[model samples]
Target: MSNTAQELKAEILRLTRDYSALVHRANRAGTENSVPFEPGKTTVPYAGRVFDQDEVEAAVGATLDFWLTLGPEGEAFERELAGFLGVKHSLLVNSGSSANLIAIAALTTHKLPANRRVQPGDEVITVAAGFPTTVAPILQVGAVPVFIDNDPATGNARVEQLEAAFSPGKTKAVMMAHALGNPFDLSSVLEFCRRHDLWLIEDNCDALGCTYSMPIARANALGIIENSPGIPANGTHVTRYTGTWGDISTQSFYPPHHLTMGEGGAVNLVSRPPLKTYAASFRDWGRDCWCASGKDDTCGKRFNWKLGELPRGYDHKYIYSHLGYNLKPLDPQAAIGRQQLKKLPAFIEARKRNWEVLREGLAEFADKFDFTLPTHATGWTPEGFTWDATGCRTECSWFGFMLRVKPGAGFTHTDLARHLESKKIGNRMFFGGNLLRQPVFVQLRKDRPSSFRVLGAMPGADEIMERALFLGTYPGLTTTMLEYELQVIRDFVRQA
Candidate 1:
């Protein structure tokens, strides 16, 4: 407001820009040489931040603006990303876990009929082999999570299990991942949702660009078919890209995920009416006002309306709508996301190409490893590489691969995993092996007889997951990195 304050702010802005420029220069200087992957020495990451100078520059540029919270960049990223996903609204959040929480929480709004909200103790069916965030939100909302055993070979939930999960008025929603880019029988899931009137949330965090045949929830609560497979939004039973299917789907922008907003994630919602779209408002700030971050009084009479028990002319901005959380991601994250979006098509293509290469290269060892490749039916595209095997095995990706050793294969998973780690070929145990068996599910298990049930016994779920590991095909991987990983497994298997 004062002359000195304005001048000081201008000077601070100048210094911030200068600092960012210096950091960019330093990062570029350090990246001049190619880094090679050395077995037993180099860390073959499952996934790592895949970025360049441009991404860093964009992020720092946002930082210099000092609009550190969700601002123009965040709004722009949400619009551009929603357009990319063929969805109506996209809300950027703090993380994938929060995205899941928001999406599920939005569905529980009183705006929908009381029965429609995922009531406490109501069952939300999901697989036991997925990332914890996928199912954590279920219990976090006080809804019972009915675990289903995944198809071990495909690492996807058995579509046939849905009918069982829904039997006798049990399920309120069905949520699951495409499972490492593999499309998980979306057709069946959607049809099941339609038949049961269950809400479907696709955890497309790992499978961003991927698509499967399904109807996109349109303006009328009507599922409209798409004419073109990859085109944005057109009207047939066309492919619903992974992030576009759910009534409210979500994606992670964490560095290791499909795209990096550093520490960001997003919730994608498709509402039948614009009024319903305001439902997400509560999630953002529980505000009665629907104006953009810095704007005011889009409703034209911000202080004229009488809402709740407040005075006759209350400030609309402070009116709380839905009980919500401050889970929004920062503008810098969105700035990075804008840069990442440009590289997404290339990233997805690289992942597909790398998967094919690994598939071909490991064909000879298929017998020994029992590697099962995902079968993408016509009109489907995958996002990542996921394969499991029965023995002293080796698989490849752009960055990491799996080393699943079956009991009958003359080696234990422990032995094979130890060998790979000792050789410096990085690996990770499959995400929360038998998630139901984990401690988080301890409370849920006690009432399993009355409140929940697994669609089937999950001994195979525990066995296969414990015996499997996930590596990366993320863009950060180099040829040398993949080659060394392949050789490590090849050498280990030869001994077996």
Candidate 2:
């Protein structure tokens, strides 16, 4: 490229930033630039992309380079995200669903130990009250998903039911999400996985920045050595990001999640280097070769040996390993993701603050609603949370502010939802709320009785389905908008 082209690119990026600043004021982080807000008139969204010129310029610059495929920008974003989570590697994919698919598919590789590999009849344990994709991938990979109930108070798996759902020889893994950014009961879950020698796959898409800590002695017993990169050790507990505690985890970078890259997600190889190789293969069309996009063998001799009865030195790139899909996102999307990564610390803090604002404002109605608690938290006050006897603790980068309408609270959740909708205050239910009750799973049970297992009646899941709803805690919410939401809810409750 000539100097003329370089100068033109610079000029274009400067103009792009100016254009974004003028046109995207409403999309900026809260209080970054003011936007007009009206009470019960301006629509408030539950979640959305919150970006500024930095992300726009990054996206525009990557597009100008015209390397559309997953290339330099994608590699850099993968490295940055993995570093942030203190994981071995983060492989970019097209969506969180695909990331989950690749994460589970990697475990099905022939390279894994026979007993640990998730074979056709093997079972993977999961909760019954979360997103569909988290459980869909288990069935997609030909493994049964044993369903356990969730604790409605935390919107997380009821870990006490783990043994009831596990089969001595059939169960090979426990895969569950940290629902709504609240880290699940990792202490109990990890212990169960350790005792049973089962792999733990954390669906961390909703919980990018959440941290889970356990007593140093307990953490050491689980083979955890160090705290996540920048987290200071207090000499009492080993605190690490949620994704780092499990063998493998997944993240979503879609517009509604913690960050936005338009449409992107990643699979984090937490503790094992070999899992990166397996996961990368699954992400890149199931090819046995580990070469990155537009690159040759990192493994010196690409034409070294034969496998699967193929001709010796067959183009290694052509070698097929697992039945994989093409899940990679484009370079420009990753470039935007990189900018978002730079803002993540602030974004996380904003989410926490927003949750607190809503919680504190709504505390007067405690008798009519039950709010979610971080795992291991017994109660909450204006000062802080009270913990259980266990030494485990979680700091949530909350995805939403969830509340369960109390039974016989003068109105149903739907009534409250309708009132909020009338007032243009956005809300959402717990995603899929008892996924077993969904049509697809109901039909699956009829089609193949042995395909999945349910440990109990899931009364807790039923409660979430019937009573739970969540308001936005995303960084984009302005204080005025939040105040309006509080006022509307308070008015509605008072009328009821």
Candidate 3:
């Protein structure tokens, strides 16, 4: 590039920074006491994008480059994210829903041995109380989703039911999310999967910074090493991030997620190289070639591959390996992600602090409602945690503060939710609560009753569906906002 071009690029970047500062000023000024916390007036969102000039500038800089597709920014973001999560590889996708889809679809690839590959009609153990997308991929792949109950207190799958949900040689995988950023019982789930030789896919989209401690042997078996510089070197167990505990895990980078890339997600390859290849193939148009976008012939003999009865010297780039989708985010989105990633540690800390404040502030009303705090296999208290018998532990990066209206309480879930809404305080039900009760499942059951299986009646799941809701613990929630929310809740409970 000539000196004139270099100067022009610098000017463009400087102008972008100036524009970004203006945006930041406008955003802050607009939101500053914009609406007083009067009933039915102020709106406190349950989740939202919390960003500043850096993210805007990065995005504008990438747009100026005009490399619209996944490129250098995407590659760097992927590496940085994988390193943050202590995982081997992270393949970017268009959305968390697509990440879940590709993660499951990759398991069905022929790259795995026939015995290990998830075949059509095989069962995948999952919970039915959370988001639909977490379970949708199993059905999409023509596999049966074996439904299990969720623990109302934690809003996670009931781990004790693992054995009941298992079917030897028939249940091929276990795919579930860490509900609302609270991790499930990774110890029991890992043990169950290992015992049964089933694949594990942790939907880590909601719990990116959460940590779980497991026996070293088990962690190593899943290809996780506890080697962070600051963490204590305990020889017996390894404390790995939630995303690294499974054969495959996923992350969402939507505006409301832990990090924001506007609309992006990633399928993390935690255990196997072949799984990475398969997932990448599925993401990159199902082609046999491993080449990045706009590049070719990474395999050297791109014209000399013949696996599926095509001409012997057919171009490898066009060879369809598995049925797949083009689910990739743009380079500009990834550039924003790179900036967001730098802010993630602070964001996670803010979330944790906000949750603690809510927990503490609402302790007085604990008798009125069941506060759903994060739990682990090990019992926890404010002072410290007691390790489970196997020495397993969990550290959560909470996504929200869940509250379940206790049975026999004067106020019902609907009553409290309505009151919160009337106060313009945002809240959310556990996503698709009791998903089996959803219309789609009801219709499926009515039409083809054999499509999915359920374990014994899901009373716990019913409890959550009837009583559970959550409030924002995202980094965007300021102390003033939380105090106002607390006051609103206090007023509602006292009146009730």
Clashes of each: 4, 0, 0
Model 2, span 217-306: residue lDDT tens: 999998997999899999999999998998999999989899989999999999889999999999888999998899987777788858
Give each model a TM-score: 0.84, 0.99, 0.94
| Worst 10-residue lDDT window, candidate 3 | 26-35
Model 3 over residues 267-358: C-alpha lDDT tens digits?
A: 99986888988999899899888888778898899988878989898989889989988999999999999988888888888888888888
Candidate maximizing lDDT: 2
Question: lDDT of all the models against the reference?
Answer: 0.69, 0.93, 0.85
TM-score of candidate 3 relative to the true fold: 0.94
Residue pairs clashing in model 2 are: none
Candidate 3: residue pairs that collide = none
- Return the candidate ranking by lDDT, descending: 2, 3, 1
Deviating ranges (above 4 Å) for candidate 3? 25-41, 215-230, 234-236, 377-390
List, residue by residue over 258-290, the lDDT tens digit for candidate 1: 778878888887544442344456456767777
1 or 2, greater by lDDT: 2
- In model 1, the Cα lDDT at residue 243 comes to 60
lDDT for model 1: 0.69
Candidate scoring better on TM-score of 1 and 2: 2
